[model samples]
Target: MINTLRANLANGIQTSSTRKFRSATRLLTFAAIAAFGLASTSSASAACNGGSTLKGRFGVLVSGGTKAGAGKYVDGTMTFDGACGVNGFVSVGENGTVNNFISVTGSYNTNADNTISLSLALPNGTETYDIGFSPIFGEAIGVETDGTAYATIDLKPQTAKVVSSAPVTTYNNATLKGTWAAACTAGSPGQVDLNYITIDGSTSNYGTFGNVTGVDHIYQAQFGIQPIAGQYAVLSDGTFGGSLTVAGAYPFGFTGSISSNGNELQYNVIYGTGVIEACIAKRVS
Candidate 1:
């Protein structure tokens, strides 16, 4: 009986040791997997190369106030050198009128934390912005940093990278042959205008000049929906312009650039009311 009891005690000790060994092995395996996941996340976040990541042409939109006045809006295309220099043309609206396309020059720097700083020399003065990049979306988003003005800016790649297909190098009238939904904002400090428009650009009645008809719904005015008629023309380089009459009376002009994928358009309106208006349209059909 004594021998049997001793044997039983020895077996119990061996079993407990085996169980502890298995538990330790599982803990090590879990720790290794967690470390691998953390390493992957760190590597992905490290891919941002700062301002040098911005290259080629980017469609730009700027809307807000300047040090002198309110309601300044700008939209155009900017070409970045992937180093420090940038130049572009923009249509600026201010003081009850919209200026013709004007040239703008700017310089940018990369911060230690991977953020970007930009200084744009405009016709009025130098405007500064704190810019941030999103690798997943491939865009640069920023806001005005100067105390006097309140504005926000965004830039989208004019040329899409080649992945499964060749990138769209140029665009013409037929490239915009579809329906589009547009979200737009226009305003000064006290007065703001917001509109949602559904544009039908699929009609081919006017040859290269596409007949566009849409409904403009002004949310602020509470004017449910008004029918608008317009015509648009796309340039070889994807710059588009058109005039639309709202409710058959009020007329406004607009211009913008199409994305390299031909899936989106970024545009601004010429309201000539001392307010800047910016709109982005995406294809729906």
Candidate 2:
């Protein structure tokens, strides 16, 4: 009878040991899965960099005016050192005077709202802007914050290497060779104009620089849709200038910038009269 009791106790102990072993195995498996999930999350966060991903060179466009009747338009290139420091060169048109290639220095930081704040020291004075970046990290839209000027800014990623000398990169006349869809806004106080344009950038067109041929469909209360043909040029630095003219319509000159990846462009119009104009173009094909 003692032998029989001993055997039963041994069997019970073995069963208990088996259950403990299974419980430990399950806990270890759970721990390993949690660890893997944590590691994956950390890697993704590092890649996104918390939306402070402003690095390398970017093409910039600013269009607007101050309250005091001085209109401002700018096309430039800004290079971020990836450490909050930045250098810029811009062709600025203010009032009736146009200055080509002016140098500016600045610093930038990202805000909680996913906006970047820039404090730039121009030759005239200091200016500040708040820029909201796109999810693709390739483009952004910004506004001036000083209350003195009403400005809208556009930023596009460029593949330029340096800003000190002429950039030797793939961003050239050929970079803009594609079909793009453009949306533009321009007007004075009571007369606003909205333009939807289709731009064809091809080498077969006629121009010293690369050719930009487009059809501008004007949407206004007076005219429903005017399919107007326009032509422009793409410079070595990816900026462009030309005119769009039609019978009984206003002939206006335009200046623009092409992104390094050849996917986007921004343009602004210049007229003798006081007007606000800007265009953003995205490649469709």
Candidate 3:
């Protein structure tokens, strides 16, 4: 089963549109196994105090490239025990029903440098991940220990707690207004393009999109400007919701929901050609 899953992940990586989704699905498959197979009651070591920083539920987005140049993204949720254990679910496809769905359980160690080492035990094998946390607390970036894959994840605390500082004001035109450093990926068959932009989200949000090629390298700026227009609403429940349109050479329809803490935004977007992309963006004001 592990070999089959690996084969599927490798095959999915070759295609641009579904690479991350496929990889996430496989991860979730192991999650499901762990949830049912592993024991839930485990004590944390004295060195694991950093787990407290990860308590609560978080929305996760993972994107990485394979040694062969295939790019993949994974979307899911992870819940930490504030001790050392973690349980989560991941999926691929529209509404998480398309290709695969999975639940995972694991142990983690928080390093002194704000990085984490995670180990997930699956029916087939154990996978290790090295994760780096953002200064914002819950947001993090990660990569496989073998360097075969890399990913970025944004986590939103599901429970109310004192953030590093007082919570930012509610999501409004004023609070949302800023120049944000944005990274995005547009995936299609045989080609996956990464985009980096400086987004000004004031009255009418607009920015320049740079076509980034080569693994983890940002080259010169490419042609064309991307424009976005949208309105955001702070729901009664404290979640942030909004919709926007990308009026550019390759247009996209985007909808997003942000955590109450105002640190991370989870987005689901569809291209004019009907290709779907999902990502998490952090506020860098």
Which one wins on lDDT?
Answer: 1
Ranking by lDDT: 1, 2, 3
lDDT (Cα, 0-100) at 284 in candidate 3: 63
Model 3 lDDT, residue 268, Cα: 45
Q: lDDT for model 3, on a 0 to 1 scale? A: 0.46
| Pairs of residues at least 3 apart in sequence or in different chains that clash in candidate 1 | none
- Candidate 2 regions with alpha-carbon error over 4 angstroms: 1-53, 69-72, 93-101, 110-115, 122-124, 134-136, 160-169, 190-200, 203-207, 218-227, 246-251, 274-276
lDDT of each: 0.63, 0.58, 0.46
- Identify the candidate with maximal TM-score: 1
What is residue 224's positional error in candidate 3, in angstroms? 6.0
Q: State model 1's lDDT.
A: 0.63
Which stretches of candidate 3 lie above 4 Å from their native place? 1-50, 92-101, 111-114, 121-126, 134-138, 160-182, 188-257, 268-278, 282-285
Residue 158's lDDT in candidate 2: 69
Listing every candidate in turn, what is its Cα RMSD in Å to the true structure after a full C-alpha superposition? 27.6, 28.0, 12.4
TM-score leaderboard ranking: 1, 2, 3
Better of 2 and 3 by lDDT: 2
TM-score of each: 0.73, 0.62, 0.48
